[model samples]
Target: MVAIHLTSSFLLIRHFIPFMKKKGWGRIVNISSINGLIAMPGKAPYCFMKHALIGLTKAVALETAENGITCNAVCPAYVETELVMKQIRDRANQNNISYEEMRVAALVGFLCSDEAGSVTGCAIPVDAGYTAR
Candidate 1:
């Protein structure tokens, strides 16, 4: 889980950074969860990895800020992917809570574009206002 969530991103970033640096422009976006920002019961490993991912995003963003490269993480709550759907089902059953879907593609697209060149080192939440609570 650590490798899948955190180490893989680190390795990929390390591998691509030089190429991006040479090219003079790049965008590195990571998919994180609300767990990255807030803690929930019975999700320690997942939360830990996600939080580390945010930290990685910020650190890498700083490292490559001046090189026409940006790194950011999108922290969404229960996106509508298959794996997430399963988790949501399980969680809903366990806690008897309602569910909602959120998508990060548009924000990710914006982040990858020239308009967001000035935006870096951000853990932007796309949690349908759940973080507001």
Candidate 2:
């Protein structure tokens, strides 16, 4: 994940900075995760790596600010993706619960409203408000 995400981001900045320099404007949005902000019980590695990515985004943002390049990290908690469904299943298995139960427990009553968009420069908990409590 680090290689794919961080490495690619570094490469993009290296390769695209010249173009951005000529154009005088650019926006780079890195897809970070809420794990980067708040640690979970069983996802230490993911949390650590994502935190690192956030750091990278901040560094890049600072480096390119004078160049009119904006680098930011978008931290979404849990979107309804296939990979997330698999995680739900895994959680179900780990907790010995029904899939539906796990899904509800995973998502119900813990979501963020779209207006939360104002939050940035850190992880955004789109996890149905998982971190709210």
Candidate 3:
């Protein structure tokens, strides 16, 4: 999955750079997760993959800067999406807790704070400041 994501992004950038250069402006935003920034127990693969995405974004941003192209990754924590619900369910099962309890705990642990918008090439933890504490 990581390979596919990275390869497709690279191919797209390669194909689009000429057009962007001609137009002299372009922005590429990659959606990453807070998990990409901080490692969580039992989620080694996710942590590894997200960190790789950040690295890829940084490398691409540097390579494309001269061409008026900017590549950035937006890291959001525990948004109220289906994916979050799935994670809640998984955690509930793994920890033998109620779904509601798991949900609240997850939110409290990972999604309770404002994001730092000024940081780049840095993991923006939208997980409610989970890393802050």
Best by lDDT: 1
lDDT of 2 by residue, 1-133 (tens): 6787577878877898789768777666676777877889989878888888899877876777676666666666544478698876665676576666533222222222233223323334443344575
In angstroms, how far off is 12's CA in candidate 3?
Answer: 2.8
Task: Give the runs in model 1 whose Cα sits over 4 Å from its true position.
Answer: 83-101
Summed backbone clashes in each candidate are: 0, 4, 5
Off by over 4 Å in 3: 3-5, 83-123
Clashing pairs in 3: 110-127, 111-127, 111-128, 112-128, 113-128
Candidate 1 per-residue C-alpha lDDT over 4-60 given as tens digits, one digit per residue, 9 for 90 to 100: 999999999999999999999999999998999999999999999999999999999
Q: List per-prediction Cα lDDT, in the order shown.
A: 0.89, 0.63, 0.61
Best by TM-score: 1
Q: Which TM-score value belongs to model 3?
A: 0.63
Model 2 ranges with Cα > 4 A deviation: 85-125
- Number of backbone clashes in candidate 2: 4
**lDDT measured at residue 95 in model 1 versus the true structure, 0 to 100:** 53
Q: Rank the candidates by lDDT, best first.
A: 1, 2, 3
